[model samples]
Target: MVVRTFGISVLVTIASLVVAFIYGSWEAVALCAILGVLEVSLSFDNAVINATVLEKMSEFWQKMFLTVGIIIAVFGMRLLFPLVVVWVTAGLNPVQAFDLALNPPAEGSGQESYEQILTDAHPQIAAFGGMFLFMLFLNFILAERETKWLSWFEKPLATIGKLDQLAVIIAGLSLTLVAEFLADDQHRATIMIAGVLGMITYIAVDGLGSLFHTEQLEEDHERDVASRAAGGPSTLVKATGKAAFFLFLYLEVLDASFSFDGVIGAFAITADPIIIALGLGFIGAMFVRSITVYLVRQGTLSDYRYLEHGAHWAIGALSVILFISIEYHINEIITGLVGVAFIGAAFLSSVVANRREERSDGDSTPKSGGGESPSEMATATD
Candidate 1:
């Protein structure tokens, strides 16, 4: 699988180069390379979190991730979703909006085209990213801890929640409303609030699952045992339903988080819808699928719990940064770099933690571990 993935990566690089050179759009190639690398680096925490959560999924669901999940990432987010955002935010009919995108009016002239409007409103995007950053921080910091809380209300608050899918839908709608009511200059805060609400909704559901009164796991040894015990071929039938649902939802959201940066970055490269849709669609979907596969087969995440936490935190940070850029008018490159830095720090911390554990054990090996090996981990799920 590793070799195959590497080969695909090489092929993609070559293909990107060929396409860029052929179209005489050396810029596209550079942008492709930049965006591709940015997605991977900034998304490491995403990969770890994805792998850890995906471990619970059934094979069919994992397959769905590679298929349906990709459609959401490459094509949906970069291509269709943005158009939807444009139409809803700007209140232009689809035909007119797309026409604007296709033939963006000249810069500084304030043309009628959607692309021109978007370009004219480009500072609005950065401002959105900035507000997104602060909103994310609020959700992470003020939203209360999910694992264990200091107060009693936390548990009741958690257990009363419904499906996480609802949260995504609501957040999407909230963004639409924000785009509707808020002016370009003032929308960053609105974007941030929407993002925070989205996260709060996700945690509300997942936290409810965690609050289900499972047996407490106290030690690494116990966790390792539970991890090993989770692996019965017989369990595959039951595991599929739970695992697939989580994996699908996870992939969908992760793709959205990833595209927040990619879509914005793509605008910097070129606003051509065809180019954006085609290039981003194929590339984003492909990499996300590849990432899902790596997590499934390798089981690397089973040994690295903190890594997933780091990724989520990084994602949380990126989301906030994106929201903030909406109003602050910061550069897109800086936003990407900040996210990349967060992921990088988390990754380095993971590597260090892994090495420290290895040294402590006098062996650079991780004993297979997870929540499934014992009744405790399984109970944690239930």
Candidate 2:
């Protein structure tokens, strides 16, 4: 199962490394490998969140996610998105932006390097991505659920969530505060606008998807009841057509939001666009896709009930880090480790809970009346 899932990612990693070596020798290879690992580690929580969405999609859409989705994630987000950011922020044409990326301005020169332009634009970028992810975390924690990993914390939040649009109000206030204090005077308006747009984008995409999904559920329930009345087999219904398309679109946007930090952080390691694409887009993204599918197929989220909660908490931490990074540069290692710590702790807690449940079930079982239970008899004979 592991090979079936990660085989393509491994092959792509090798290919990307080989290309990196050919492009700039062993140094490029090392940088590419490091960036690939960095992206995977940083985006581990992204995979978990993605699995929760992807499992709702039909098989055809899931296949599209592996194929068409990867293309968009690699070229669109990792490569073209950065170029577009440079073009927009730096006021350069497409060709000029590409050239600037390839031949970055030297340090101490009057002109800024490609990385500098992107970094300078970080306030707006961080505002957009951070707000979008913050909404996701807010909605997750605020919504009531049957299973609670952090019950003491989540229960209060769920009660607070009963207020309509509470997530939006909090997110808006948070964005305003960040733009007012954390952002520079020149970038403040832009940050505010970008953050508002991010919130709108999430609302539109998630809202439309939920609307269609609820309709689908209602239709499915009707069909199920009719089928039962007619004494016919009741078929399962999965999201497809418009419903699945919106879900797919939502997933892509989520991926874009997650990629903002990783793409910007990669520049700290190297300013080469080609190398970054090879490492982050080709290798890192493919592996994330594989991990998402693996989790869905293995039912890992169901087995380890707290894993999704952990991922969302990690996302909340990341959103805060993104805001902090706008004013002060936080190490990518710190960002990645924070996510890993949340996921690891949740996983261990889940293991302990599972064992405790097993022991409770064992103790609660009724004993045979005629004699000692089989297990007790065996122990007595021993």
Candidate 2: deviation at residue 196, Å?
A: 0.5
lDDT score at residue 39, model 2, on the 0-100 scale:
94
Give the winner by lDDT: 2
lDDT of each: 0.56, 0.94
Stretches of candidate 1 exceeding 4 Å from the true structure: 9-25, 107-110, 119-239, 362-382
lDDT of 1 by residue, 1-382 (tens): 7877555645765775577657647776666666666556555555655666566556676667666776677667777766876787788776767777877778678546555456444444433443343333333333434442223543453343343344345445545544554436455555455555555545543554333312222233465566678973322222344334644664575556556666766676677765675566655446655775676687655554444545555666665555445444556566556666765665576677778887887664333375244566657779
Q: What lDDT score is found at residue 187 in candidate 1?
A: 52
- What is the total number of backbone clashes in candidate 2? 0
- Report the C-alpha displacement of residue 164, candidate 2, in angstroms: 0.8
Q: Global CA lDDT of candidate 1, please?
A: 0.56
- For candidate 2, lDDT tens digit of each residue in 143-249? 99999999999999999999999999999999988988888889889989999998999999999999998898888889999999999998788888888999999
